[model samples]
Target: MSFKTIAAILQGEQEFQRVLDCAIPLASRLEAHLVGIHAEVLPVPYTAAAGFPDTDFIQVSTELNKEATLKLRGTFHERVEDAGLSFEWRTLESFSGDGTLAGLPNVRAADLIVAAQRDVESDDGTDVESLVYDAGRPVLMVPHSGPILSSFRRVLLAWNGSREAARATFDALPLLIEADQTDILIIDPPESSDDTPDAAGSRIAASLGRHGVSVGVSVRNSQGQSVETLIQDRLAASGADLLVLGAYSHSWLRELLFGGVTRSILRSAPVTVFLSR
Candidate 1:
């Protein structure tokens, strides 16, 4: 019903602090054990045209990565000490490739994973998609740069009647129940013989109401605009602090090639997003 263990992905100096800033308060609020995971990528030696390896470059890169890891660990310990919460630090060394992959084990074990939204502009080589898709747990993605979330009050649930949507809604029940108000926003609803827009929304609202959550439903037509645009507009209008939705309801490869709702939301949702695949 509540998060018992929360895993936070720490990528760089600035992002580490930002993710921790949000994760600390969330862990405190839920009284959950916090785990900080840092994946240290080891540099591989490059070969010259004649097949000679650049040993010096490799050695220097290794030392730099080690120093960075040490500094990050020290900062993590200091922050955890100040917070005085149940916490653990995990450091994984990447021997093969994409150091962030080393943290997958911790991600798999966690009840919830906290990570920063991907920054395509200044990417730090963190594979956030893998963490979300491969972890098999709900991911709480904080905006790369936005208002820090000390708590979630108003929540907006993006419902589309997919299994992923249902899972995300249930997974976020703890937050929904705790929120002052939760709005269900149905955009460009499908025309089904069995259910109308109002009927579909009412069914979910009634379920949430049974759990003692203050629930409201709104169906928007989107007016021929992208669903993501409409969702963002609604989010601002509703003033919801958190967004709960299923991730990648469509095929991942399809989304990667042709844009989909999941990709659009991940790239530019202003508020915190709770996503499960």
Candidate 2:
């Protein structure tokens, strides 16, 4: 299905506009609605046992939060307008702790979520940090410090014979269809079909070609290294601004373990990565 609405989560950071820049072209190509969202950290609940002095502190803190929200909203709106895209801007108010990713409503309605990947040291446990895992949708995570991709001219699809990768391919169909050149690069594809389960890669390429995407397909050995490093190197070497692939490769251990490629991309992704789990 085509994406009709694109939602971007912002925190009024210096790189917020860059996130917008990366998303607008996708929105324009899909002719989709764009939305910019910022979350407001609500006041911490105060109990009677905390005493009168603590109550006063809570009130002052709440006021400061409100003022910060207003300023952030104003600045965000101005930037969204400057991008020449019609956008709805909203400040989400939630009492959940920062690690909770406070804006589920925004995630619920968005077809895609655009966010800047943040590190543990940089994150104050804000909603931004959880957008990737909790959004329940594909997240096109952009690096916090990097060049904004102007267009999807060159793209690399990190393919493996897995269901997650299949889902990610479908999620990225819109962008891939519009890309100037698209390549389905399977790192160390099996020697025979027996080792590799049949996948939707070829079908996706055909579908995109029907929609005018320049497509090429190839599979190569990753030489026994972690698949993640190989994929990152391929993306950088190909000058691919967009990398589309699955988010998690395995989860049978009762815990989430990102596939090698997924983890590597998270740490040193040179460009934008569109992922669906």
Candidate 3:
């Protein structure tokens, strides 16, 4: 029940160090391998047609991008050395196409994906978006400025009985079962009347119990609070450091038309959240 491999996307010197600082501590706690990924987007090729001008455009773009990549690689190596952790750095040089990073083999091999919230106006503001969607891993998105987590002492499981929620719960088992306190909170249409005192909740609780985890379950009516608001309120009141939930309850279009819980959580959560879909 520990992370074995952690993959983090390196964007720049400052942000890369910030994410590494957050991730290395967690890696040390888990005794995990840290794999730093520098996804290098090669400059787009602009071949000049016959008699066309600007022959040096592609060469200049390539040189500039290479320089940026080298600087970032140097920074990553120094940070990894400073942390004194077993780590590996990888570089992928390619022209970014739709589904580029998604196809990366390294991303598929990692147990956890750590991402930093990037400020817009960088990389045309597309790097963060692509990493979140295409990483194909359970992403731990670190905010640009927040208290970094050393442990999942308190965890809140946002349950809705959907497949995605189930996946999220299972994916977070390592943290949940080891946490100081773990609460499985379900909010929905309402608990069923025919449901036994311990039915679905007990099943999950039992599994954790076998792991010797301190666990509890509770059901609450949404009571008109938006899912985001409800989650934030629970985070504040319970002092939970991690939240486990399904990602993207509804499709993008449907959620946009009518707010969905998953969308709200992704947009902003009061605490660190682990999501799977």
Candidate 4:
């Protein structure tokens, strides 16, 4: 249940240090091999009126991208060498619009993926959503604006009694077992044929308790507020260092159209989020 290999996605110079700040400590703690993945995007050449390619534009863009990749690689090597962690770097040239797709293969091979939270302001062309949904591995998303967490001491699990929730609960077992406190929080729980609202989080609490996790259950009525809002409020109030939850319990298409819980939380989670599909 422990991570043996960690994949850290490096998008740009701005996020590289922050992602490494989180990934290095996590790898050190888990004693896992760290793999740094960078996707160098190739700019598309424009066609002339006669369909001739713009060679000069293409050449300049290629050189700039190459230089940027080299600089990022150098920084990665320097940091990893100083950290003294077992590490490797994988760099790929991506021609597609989504640069992060270039690192998909490495991400698929790793036990866990560490990535920076998406920057809504910039269109950097990185596809973190694809990595999270398609990587076939758990992803720990570091907040874009927060102090990096050295350890997950207090964990909060968002449970909804769905298959995805159950999967996430077990997928995060190692962290939960190690946490000093793990709270199972259920909001606006649906009335199941077998379970009641008052006891919504009881089942999962019991299961985690059996695994030797210091677990507690809390059920809160949404009271017409968005579930995402409540989750953030709770995270702030409890000062939980990490949040564990299932990703896309609803279909991706549905979430895109209707704004599901997973999407909301992914956009603005207050703490580090561990998500498993």
lDDT scores in order: 0.85, 0.71, 0.71, 0.85
Q: Under the 3 Å rule for N, CA and C atoms, how many clashes does model 4 have?
A: 0
* Tens digits of lDDT, candidate 4, 106-127: 7888988888888777766356
Consecutive 10-residue window with the lowest summed lDDT within model 1: 95-104
Given candidate 2, what's the lDDT at residue 157?
A: 88
Q: Model 3: residues >4 Å from true position, as ranges?
A: 46-53, 94-103, 118-135, 193-200, 256-259
Model 1 Cα shift for residue 76 (angstroms): 0.7
Tens-digit per-residue lDDT, 218-269, candidate 3: 7666778777777788888899998887776567567668867766665566
Could you tell me which residue pairs clash in candidate 3?
A: none
Tens-place lDDT per residue, model 1, 122-191, is: 7564566666677789999888888879578999999988899999999999889999999999987777
Q: Kindly report the root-mean-square deviation of model 2 from the true structure over all alpha carbons.
A: 3.5
Query: How close is every model to the real structure, measured as TM-score?
Result: 0.94, 0.83, 0.83, 0.94
Cα-lDDT of candidate 2:
0.71
Q: Provide the lDDT at 54 for model 4.
A: 86
What is the per-residue lDDT of model 2 for residues 122-188, given as tens digits with 9 covering 90 to 100?
6432344256556778888877677777457788987775888888887888778768888888766
In model 2, where is the ten-residue run with the lowest total lDDT?
252-261
